[model samples]
Target: MALLKGWRYGVFISGIVGLIGLAIYPVVIDPMLHTDKYKEVQKHNRAGVNQEAIQPGNMKVWSDPFGRK
Candidate 1:
């Protein structure tokens, strides 16, 4: 009764704390620990060599034998 209720409460609190930690980690810890990958991606994006060409009226069609188009 009481013991089960206390255990549930503890688990709930722990889950909330874990979620908060996960939310904070990407915003704070990740940038501090790993900066090289982000910088490289940013530089690549700025270089303008990875852009994809999209033409008007160009649509991809997939063949499906089991279902409708």
Candidate 2:
């Protein structure tokens, strides 16, 4: 019974520490690692409305192919 109690206490402390680490990691670490991708996604979402007129991978995407430029 004493051994079981000690095991339970160990598990309980470990679980609390894991939760605290997870809570802090996102606020302190994830942003630094993921900011570029996050910003790119945001920029893409904002520019989605203009995509119809400017297809990707084309240098003269703004101008039509038939000498519109």
Candidate 3:
């Protein structure tokens, strides 16, 4: 029972640490690493453009010639 309790405690502590790291990352690491990318995204947003919008050339139209409807 002690071993099981220890394992559970370890898992709980590790989960808490992981959560803290995730919370810190966006506040600290993301701005430090991707500031330029964020700025470009903001610029596009201000210009009424969605960065995720697909371009025309990338569209795929599937035509099934061999499959029966």
User: Relative to the true structure, how large is the alpha-carbon lDDT of every model?
Assistant: 0.68, 0.69, 0.70
* lDDT score at residue 22, model 1, on the 0-100 scale: 99
* TM-score of each predicted structure versus truth: 0.49, 0.43, 0.45
Candidate 2 collision pairs: none
State candidate 3's TM-score. 0.45
Model 3 worst lDDT window (10 residues): 59-68
Candidate 3: segments with Cα more than 4 A from true spot: 1-4, 39-69
Clashing pairs in 1: none
Q: What is the overall TM-score of model 2 with all chains considered together? A: 0.43
Estimate the lDDT of model 3: 0.70
Model 1, CA-based lDDT: 0.68
Arranged by lDDT, best first: 3, 2, 1
lDDT for each residue of candidate 3 in 1-69, tens digit (9 for 90 to 100): 355477788998899999999999999999777777776776676586543464466665433223358
- Please state every model's RMSD to the true fold in angstroms: 12.5, 12.4, 13.1
lDDT, candidate 1, residue 58? 58
Q: What's the lDDT for residue 42 in model 2?
A: 66
lDDT of 2 by residue, 1-69 (tens): 345468788998899999999999989888667777666676676674675555657555353222323
In candidate 2, which residue ranges exceed 4 Å CA deviation? 1-4, 38-69
